[model samples]
Target: MNHGAFRPIELRAPEGSVVDVRDDAPAGAHGEVRKRAVSVALGALSQIIPDLVSGDLCGTSFPNAIGE
Candidate 1:
């Protein structure tokens, strides 16, 4: 998985509990914080998507547009 971009998603536990998960880290920071955020996002997605789809829409296409 890419160690960048923020992907927010909602997850529900087996007991019907819902939680909001997000990757709220600044782009271009390839440190521990950014890695953790990416891991969390990926973990949440793994638990949510039965059959994950791989595509360009999964990340920020214009990463360089904002002067990062």
Candidate 2:
């Protein structure tokens, strides 16, 4: 096996946040963990709720707002 050619990679979270895990977790588990972590973080932020629910925070300008 050519071990020299392999390198460890560091994963990064999106621009506005930090990642909690970088180990060899499965894709589905990673996604669920990330989703729950994001939900909790955003829930703590609180003010982002309306914009998240409204979908206009991203500047797409939701025509009907959520749950219309």
Candidate 3:
């Protein structure tokens, strides 16, 4: 009756390597990861900050990043 267990994958990349893109490609790739991370963090914060301040956790989640 194990319902919460899961497996993990092992991925390793060497230094100075493009883990996400092809090697030695001229690409504006750094912003995508950061932007996604920030967007997700802000979304989560929006869903939690109201309850954290007002002590009520019944509010629906809202999209904090309007331009996404």
Off by over 4 Å in 1: 1-30, 53-68
C-alpha lDDT score of every prediction, in listed order = 0.46, 0.46, 0.49
List the candidates' TM-scores in order: 0.32, 0.32, 0.33
Q: Write the per-residue lDDT of candidate 2 for residues 2-63, one digit (tens) a residue.
A: 87553453555764343544345334344445555556555655675454331123222223
Residue 38 in model 1: shift from native, Å? 0.3
- Clash pairs, model 1 backbone: none
Candidate 1 lDDT over residue span 2-67, tens digit each: 765546555453432123223463334344334454566666667778367232233333333355
Error of 2 at 22 (Å): 5.6
Best by lDDT: 3
Candidate 2 off by > 4 Å: 1-28, 47-68
lDDT of 3: 0.49
Give the Å error, residue 47, model 1.
0.7
lDDT of 3 by residue, 1-68 (tens): 37645243355656565445565764454555445544655566568774432222333343344442
Q: What is the lDDT of residue 41 in candidate 3?
A: 50
- List candidate 3 stretches off by more than 4 Å: 1-28, 50-68
